[model samples]
Target: MNTPQQTESIKNLVENIDKGNIVLPEFQRDFVWEIKKTCELFDSIVRDIFIGSIIYGKPTFEITVREIDTRPRKGQGSRRKLKITSFDKGEINQKSQISNFRLILDGQQRATSFYRALKGIDEIWFIAKSEDDLDNEIKTKEYKDRSLEEMLYTFSLQEDEERISIKLSEAYEISKGDMFDEDIKENFFDNLLFVVAMNDAELKDNFRRYKTLCMKLGELFKSELLLSYYLLNMDNEKFALFFERSNSKGIQLNFIDILAAKLYKGFNLRDKIDELESRYPNFKFDREIIVRTISYIVSNGKDIDRNYILSNLNYDHFNLYWDDICKYYNQVLDFLFQEDLAISQNWMPYENMVIPLIIFLRESNQNDFSQMNEWQYEFIKYWYWASILSQRYSSGSNEAILQDSNVLKSIAKGIKITDRVFFTRLKSQIDSYEDIFSYSRKVNVIYKGILNLINYNSMGLTDWNNSSKLSFSKKLEDHHIFPKEYIKQQFKNDEQAISLMDCVANRTLIPKITNIKVGKKKPSRYMTELKASNEKLDSTLKEHLVPTEIVEGLYDEFFNEFIEERAKLIFDLIKKTIIEKEKQIIDQYYLAPRVQGNIKIFATYYSKKLEATLDVDSQKVLLLGESHSVSSAADKAKYTLSGKGDTSTNGWRFWKYIDNNGQERYIDEFRK
Candidate 1:
C-alpha cells in the first residue's frame, strides 16, 4: 500500500498517460480549462513556479475509468478515437499492474492540460530559445500588433534559427533521451545556442553564460522534481471521501461533481443534467437546481442541502422520479411563460423557486396550472408573488423550499394550511412594496418582481407611440422618465437624487424606437410631446404606472416627490389586483385571530420619534397617517437617522412591541 507523496518528471507523466497507466475516473468532470489557462500552466512550468500537486487514488475495488480526451479542439485539428478501458483490483493484481495503474482524483484539469500540451495533442506548444528571441519577436511588425493569446498560439515550430523558437514537444523528446548520447544533447543545445548567438551577441561571446542558459532550457523538460503527486491506497468508499476532501480547498468540487462520482455505478448525474439541458434548450435550468430538486423530492422534502444530496441522493431514487420530475418541470416552464411571470430564465426572480413549484405540480398530479381548480390556481399565483416580493428565496432557500413544499403539498391534498405566519409574511411583503425603491439597472430580485407585477397588470408593456403591446420578441428598453443626464445636471452631487433617478419607480419599459425619441429629454417634455402625438398616450402611461402629473410638473424641483408618488401608484396597482384579489383565500386559510381590545403599539426611535399600531388583520402598521409593513416602516424611520441617508432597514428587528405576556419583543417574534 503505497500511501505516500511522490515526484515524477514531466517526461514520465506524459509517457504514463500515453501508455494508459494513469487514467481519469469515470466521475471526473470534463477538461473545462480554456486554452489561455493551458498556456499559463506551460508558462509557469517553464518558469519553475509551484503549480500544485496532483493526487491519485489506487482503489482496492473495481471502478470505471476512461482515457483522457486528447483530440484537438474543434477546427483546431482532427479528432482521434478514444479507447476507454475498465480495470478491477483482481485484474490489476493478476497482471502485475498495481504499481503502474492509478486513478486521478484531484488536479485532473492540470494533469490533462499538461498531457495535451506536452504531447502536442490539442495545440502545439513552443518555447523561446532565449529572452532576446522573445523580445525580437515582439518587436516584429507581424507580432507587434498581436495580443498575448495570438502570440502564444501563433508561434510555430520553425526550422529557421532566426525565428528563435523550438517546438516544446520536439525539445522534450530530445531532452528525455539519454544524456550520454552526444547527438541528442548536441541537437538540443545547438537549437538553443543558435537562437542565442543570433539574438544576443554579448551572451554568445560569454561561453559559460550561454552554455549554462542552454543547459537549463534543455533540462527543464526532463526535470524529475518538477511535477509532484500524492498516491492514496484505499478502497472505493475511502477513495470517494478522499477525493472529495482533497478537492475541498481552492476551486472546490461542487455537489454535482461529488454526486456524479458517488453514483457512477448506475447513473451519470452530469450527463443526465446535460441531457435535460439539451431537451429543454429554451429553458435555462441550472444544474444545481436540477440536482437539488431531485434531492428534495427523493428525501420527501426532508433536506436538499449539498451534503444530503452528495450522500443520500442515489441512482434508484433519481431513476424513479427523474422522468416525472422532468415532465412536471416542463409544465412549470409553461406556467411561468403563460402567466407572464418570466419570459426568459434570466427574468425569473429566483430560479430555485422552481423546486417548490415542481413539488406542488407533481403532488397535485396536474399536467399544468390549467388543470388546477380556481382555489388551487389562485393559491399558487399568490405563493409565487409572495415568494418573489418577500425575496423569500434569497438566502437559506432550501429550508424555505422545504417549508413551502409541505404547505403546497397539504394544499394539494385538500388540507387547509392555516399558517398565520405565512399570511402575515405575505401581507407584509405586499405592504413593504409601498416604500420600496430598487435600482432598475441592477440585478435585484425585488426589482424584477416589481417589473413582473407591472407586466402582469398591463398584460404587456405597451409602446408609448404605437400603443402596441411589447412581447418577448420585441426589443424593449427600461427608459427613465426623467432622462439620466437631466437628473444628473439638476442634482449634481446628491447621491440620493441620483439613486432616485434610477429607481424602478422612475423607469418604464418602452420599445427601442420610443426610447430613442425620449432620450436625454425631460419627462415633462417627452410626455407632453407623446400626449399630443398619440391619442391613447394617457392610458399607456397609466398601464406603465407612470403618473400623469409628471407631464406638467417641473421635475428638477419635485423629483423626490415624483418618485414617491409613482411608487405609491405601482404599489396600489399590485395591491388592488394581485393582493386584494386573493385576499379572500388568505383570510380563510391563513388569518390569525384579531385582538380587538388589546391593540399592540410598536415604536422605534432613531433621530426622531416614530410610532405605529399593528393592524394584525391587515398585517400592516398605521404609521404617520399611512399604512406600511414593519419592514418598510423601519426603512422610513431610518431615512433621517444618518447623514448617509440609508433607508434599507430590517423593520422587524428595529420595531419593538410588548407581547401578550408583557415581555418586550421585536416585531420579528410574530414571524416565529
Candidate 2:
C-alpha cells in the first residue's frame, strides 16, 4: 500500500539477473537493445564518474544487493550476493557476482572488457595491457602493421587495482573466443558513452525529462528485469499513466499509446491504419474515429450514448474491439482500395454520408459492410467534416476549423432531431391527400440553398468547362462565375446589382488554367469554349449528374433555364434525399415514437411568404418562399398571383394540418 520510492544503492536491492531467472512481464518490452548502445552507456558512466561531470543530473539511478542460492556447481551450493543496479527504473543485477566490488552501472563496455581481458584467452586480447604475451593474438590495423594496443587502459587498471581480483565466469571467454578485436571494442565503447552523456544532459534541461529517462533505460535493460517495477509493484492506474508518459522522442501519446505497448509484439496498429488510409486518400477523420468505429463494431452496434462510448474505450477493452479491428480494417480496405472512392471527380458530403457506412456494417450478416449496404453514416461523417471545413473556408483558408476538436466532436454527436412542427393554429380548408401533394411541390428558400450551388456550378456551367467540379474534388477555390466585368456590364450603374455577384452561390471552381482561359468572356462564350476543350473536364460528371451530351444540347439555353429550373431541381433533389434519409433513420432506430394532435394551422396575410403547408398548385406567379418545408401536414407551399386560381381564392389557405409533435388533425366541420 505504500508508495514506492527510487531505490538508492546497487548493494541494497535483491533481484536475480540470471539469464534463466529473468522473466519478461506481459506488459514489458522484449530485450531489444543492441551491443553498440550498451557499450556507449558504459562509456558515458565511466567518463562521468571519473571525470566528475554528473552528466545524468538528478541521482536518478540506484542499485540494490540481494542474496540467492548459487547454482549447484560440480561441487556444492553457496549463498551468493547479487548486485542489482536500477537504471531508468529497471533493475539489472549482476548475473553472478564478480569478486572485487567495482560496479559500473553506466559503462557496461569497460566492465565487460575487463572481465574478458583478464580471462587470459590466447586468441583474444585488449589494448594497453601491463605486460604483453606473444601467445595472445591481437587484431592489427593491417597485416603488415601490428602497433594497435590490445589492452585495457593503464590508468583504468591502476585505479581499480584494489578492486581488481574479481573472477569473471569462465563462460565469458568461451562465448567471445577470438572475436574481440581492438577497433570493434574501441568504437563500441566510445559510441555507448557519447549517447549516455548526451541523453543525460538533454534530459535534465528538457521538458521531456521523464520520457528521456524511460527511453534511456528501456534501451539499457532487458524487458524481463524492467517488468518487475512496471507490472509487479505498479497499480493499473499508475501503470497506465507511466506507460503514456514514456513514449519516444517525437511521439505524442494518446489512448493508442497504451495499446502500442500491449500489441507491439503482434500488430503494428499505426502502420495498419496508415496503410489502410492510403487507400482512401480522401478519407478524413481524427484518431478517435478509428477507435470509435472499432468500439461500435465490437459492441455489436449497440446504441451507446455518444459520450459514454468514448470515455469507456481504452487499451483494456481493445480485445473486445479486436473482433472487428480486422473487419473495420478490411472494410476501410474495400472503400478506400477496392472501390477507389477517391476524391477525384466525386464529392460525397461526409457529414451526412459516413453514418451510412456504420449502419451498413452493423446491419450486415457478413463481418464487413454488406455489399448491398451503401456507404452510410461513417462515410457521411467523413464527407461532412471535409465539407464543413471546406465550406467554412470557401473564401479563404485557416486551420482554425481543422484544428477545432469540438467541431469534430459535434460531428460525432450527430444531428439532434426533434418533432417540432409548423402549422399549429389550424382551421383548415382543403384537407385532402391531393391538396397535400400540390403543397409538397412548392419551391422554398431552403431548397434554394441546397440546389443553387449545383445549378450555378454543376448544371449552368456544364457547357462552360463543366467538369465534376461539383464534387469539390480538390481544394475549394471560390470562382466568380459572372466575373466582375460582366456584373458591371449587365447592370450599368447599380451598386447593389454588382454586389450580388459576390454571393457564395455564384462562386465555383474551374481548373486554374481553364478559369484563366475563359476569363472576361460572356457566359455563353465561356460555355462554348469549355464544350470544345472537353479534355480538361472531370471524368465522373456523367455519373453525378445527367449525360454530358444532354448538357451539350442544352448548353445555349442551360444557363438561363438553370437559373429558373435547374436550381429548383437541385433543391428538390436535396429535400427528397433528406426526407428519405430521415425516414430511414426513424424506421431503423428511434426506440420511442409519440404523437401529438393538439395543434392548428395558420396562413400569412400578405407577401409571398407561404406558410409551412397549403396548396399552391392552382395558383401562379410570386416571390420567394420559406427556407424549407416545415409543417407536419404538408412539406411546402408557395404564394402566386397569375394562374387560373390565384387571387380568386385566398392566397394563404390551409388544406390539412398536423401538430408540432407529429400528430395529424384533418379538418372536419361536419364532426364539429
Candidate 3:
C-alpha cells in the first residue's frame, strides 16, 4: 500500500541520517557516487533545483539494516550500534509499534552525498560566492595550496577586498540559530582572511560578507524543501519485489557487492573486512584484493578472477582460511619493510604482488624471510623483481600470476624449474631499463621499482648534505640529479628537456630537507656544496648510485653521457643486489663444503659470544648441540643476551667471521 507523499527540509533530513532514524537495507548497494556527482548535488541544492524523490519502506517483518554513512564523533567506537527490530506481522495491534526507522529504497546516492557533505565525513565541503573569493582563501598562507583539479569543487580565490566562503557543516550548525555554540564563532572567523586584517573597516566588510554567505547556506538548508519521499507499507515479499524493480535502472552492483549480499546471511563479509581494516589501519589495499585472496586460497590456486570468485567463493571456505590469510598478509608486509621494497602502500609498484606473496608464504609455511632456505629465499626475490620489471601484473595478468604461484609452490617443495618464458621476458625488460622514464611515481611501476632497487642496494639512502641515514620516518622524495630548470635551459625543446630530466636514471630518493637545498641548482653546484660540507660525500653519492666522475661535468654538453653512464651503473647495482647477491648466498652458505662463523653480542649490562657451523646443502645451522637456521640461532642468542623473547633478527647480518686477509666482516658480506 502507498502512503501519502511527504516533504522534508534538507536540514531535517541530514539530522535524521545523523541520529540513525534513517538507515539502509543489508541488500542495498553501497554509496558509489564520485566526488563530482556529490559536488553537483550541492550545487543543485544551493540553486534550489529539484533533484529527485526518495523511497522509504516500513517493514512489517524483521529485516537486517545498517546506519547511514557518517563520520563517527569523538569517543564513538569502531562501529555504530545496529538496530534490529523484533516484530510479528500478525501481532502488531497499532501502527505506532511498526518502527521509528525507515529503510531507504531509492535516492540512496543523493541522500548519502548530502549527508556526507553536511557532516564533513571524508572531506570538508565549502561554498564561496565566486571563484575569485575561493581563490583568495586558497592563497592565504594557512592554506596548503592543494591543486584545484584534485578538489571535488574546483574554485580559486585571489587576494581581494571581499573574501567570503563558509564551510557547509558550520553553515548548517549556524542555521540552527539558538542551538549554535558561541565558541564556534572563533572557528568561523578563522576560516576567513579576517584573522590577520589590520584595518577595522576591511575587517567589518569581510565579516559582513561572511554573515551573508552563512545566512544564504543556512536558508538553503533550513527553508528549502529539497527532499521528497514516498513511504511504503509493505511485507517482505512485496518489498523485495519492489526493491528489485526500483533498482533495475540504477547502477549495477559489482561482484564484491553481490558476494557481500550473498554471504551476509551466514557470515558478514563487510564486518570482517572492516575489522581487518581497523586492525591494520595503515594498510591501503582495497576490498577486491582481500576477496580475491580468499577466493584464490579456497580454490587451491585454480583461478582468482572475478568469474571464479563469483562462482565458487562461499562463506564456509572464506571463514575457514580467513585467519591464515591475515597471518600471511602480515608476513608479506614485514617482508616488504625488511627488504626496503616498499615503505608504505604509496611506494608499492604492484600491490597485486601481495596475492602471489601470500600464496608462497602460506604454502612454504615460513614465518619470515630469515627462516627461508637459500633457494626459497632467492627464488621469491627473483620472482618479485621479475614481476615488477616485466609489468607482469599490469593488465590481464591473472594467468601469469597463477603460473607464478604454481612455480612458487613447486619451489617450496625443493623443485627448481629454470626454463620459464617469464624469466626470458624479465631479462628483456631489465635490458631495456634505460628506456623507462619516471613520470609519476604513483602510476609508474618501473619508476618506483627502480627507486626501491636503489634503496635496497644502498641498504638505506643517505642524506645528500648530512651523512645521516634516510628512513621512512623522515619525509623522502624522488628528486632529479640535474635540476629540471637547468635541463630545460639546456635543451631548446621543452619536451626533450623534461624527458631527459625525468628519466628513471636521473632520479634518486633523498630526504625532503636535502631536496630543498638542491632546489633548481645545477648538479655541479650542489655537489660542490655537498662535498665541502660532508667528509664522506663520495661514499654517500655512491650509495645513491650517482657516479662521482660525472658530477662535475653534468652540464648540457655531458648530459647524455652522464645519463648513459648512470643508467648502466644502476643496472649493475640492480644485478648485484637482486640477481648476483642471491647466487652468492647460495655459493657461500648452501653449496660450500664448510663454513663457520661467530656472532658477538655486546650489551650495556653484559657481553656474550656464540659460535655456529653452517650445514651445507640444507642451509641449517649447528649451534649448542642443536640444529637451527642462522635466524633461529641469532634469535636464541638475542634472547640469551637481552632476556627477551619475540626477537626477529636477520642472522646473516648478525653473524661474522675473519677472512683470509685477517679482516672481520659480516656473514652477509659473502654476498658481495
lDDT, candidate 1, equals: 0.63
Q: Which has the greatest TM-score?
A: 1
Query: 541-600 in candidate 3: lDDT tens per residue?
Result: 898888886456545456767777888887786666555554443343232213335333
Query: Compared with the true structure, what per-residue lDDT tens digits does model 2 show for residues 251-295?
Result: 656545555555556555676567655755654434445554555
Ranked by TM-score from best down, the candidates are 1, 3, 2
Superior by lDDT: candidate 1 or candidate 3: 1
Q: Per-candidate RMSD vs. true structure?
A: 27.5, 34.4, 30.2
Residue 148, candidate 2: alpha-carbon lDDT: 21
Superposed by TM-score, candidate 3 places the C-alpha of residue 493 at a distance from the truth, in angstroms, of 5.6
Provide the clash count, candidate 3.
6
Residue 669 error, candidate 3, Å = 40
Q: What TM-score goes with each of the models?
A: 0.48, 0.31, 0.47
Please list the residue runs of candidate 1 whose C-alpha ends up more than 4 Å from where it truly belongs after superposition: 1-253, 427-434, 438-441, 473-477, 493-496, 510-517, 524-535, 549-557, 577-583, 591-672
Ranking 1 against 2 by TM-score, winner: 1
Q: What shift in Å separates residue 469 of candidate 1 from its native position after superposition?
A: 2.9
Best by lDDT: 1
- Which lDDT tens digits does candidate 1 get at residues 1-672? 366667787767788888878888887886766454665566545433456778877677777788887865432222233556676779755533545787788888888877886676645335333222233335232322433322332233222232234545555555554544456435554545233422233323323332333344456556764455435664343344444444555665544676777788888777887798788776656667667778877775667876567667788987887777877787788788777776445566788888788888877877677877877777887788877876666544665787787778767756666444566445424464434663354366667778777877776767788677766546666678888888888777766667667778877767678888987777778778887878788888788887766777655467878888888888887677556756676665563433543256655343344667776556577777788876676656555333324334445556767543233445554432
What's model 3's TM-score? 0.47
